[model samples]
Target: MRYWLYKSEPATWSWDQQKEKGAAGEEWTGVRNYQARNFMREMSVGDRGFFYHSNEGKEIVGIVEVVKEAHPDSTADDAKWECVDIKAVMDVPKPVSLEQVKAEPKLKDMVLVNNSRLSVQPVTEAEFAYVCELAGVDPEKAMKG
Candidate 1:
């Protein structure tokens, strides 16, 4: 099971919106950057990603799971890009803000650090576990309601 990070602004579509979407999930679309686009194409059903809140809070708020494979991106016609389905898994008890993440030396190499604008990025298992610990949430508690 691979892990990834997906970003969204709070006003447009926040963690709450995803949680409210319930089990059905919603397409993760509107990604325009080529790098972000590539990440979206690589995502598969059953893959998990961090539901990160960018622009507004700039923090890692919760986790999400991909429920469907890649498909056309709604933002663009002609299939210039694609999107995938991701549903809210669970919120971190304590949000790991960009500030907090940057403060930790152990997380210095995180994609959220190296690539600030990358909407979709990979996360190592060690980084994931460390984040769970920092947020005071069990990794197992992240996948279900």
Candidate 2:
């Protein structure tokens, strides 16, 4: 399965809130950037993603699974953008901070290192595994509120 990273502003939608939404998940909307929209369109069911808490925490706080494929964003008037449904899979015991990721030698070549501005980006299997290791949790564990 492919891996990816998706950032969310904590004040707007925190990890806790998403977990409360349960397995039904929520539409990944409001992605205005062309690059982010492209990534959304590429996502598929069962793909995993890093649930990043931007702004407040600025860290990779959890893991998510794409429950549905890309569809035209409902919030949009046109079909130019897309979104997917993602369920919370895991929560890092101690969030892997942006600073921590940058300091780790293993993550130097990771996309988050080279593209901090990307709201949504792809992640390699190796990088995903390393993050799970740092979080001290099994990558497959389901996250609950």
Candidate 1 lDDT over residue span 34-78, tens digit each: 888787778777777788899999988988898987889877866
Compute the lDDT for candidate 2: 0.85
Q: lDDT tens digits, residues 1-145, model 2?
A: 7899999999888899889878899888888889988888888888888899887878988889899889988898878888888888767787898899999999998888998888899998888888887878675453221
Residue 103 lDDT in model 1?
93
Candidate 2 segments whose C-alpha is farther than 4 A from its true place: 139-145
Overall lDDT per candidate, in order of appearance: 0.85, 0.85
Clashes of each: 0, 0
Determine which window of 10 residues in candidate 2 has minimal summed lDDT.
Answer: 136-145
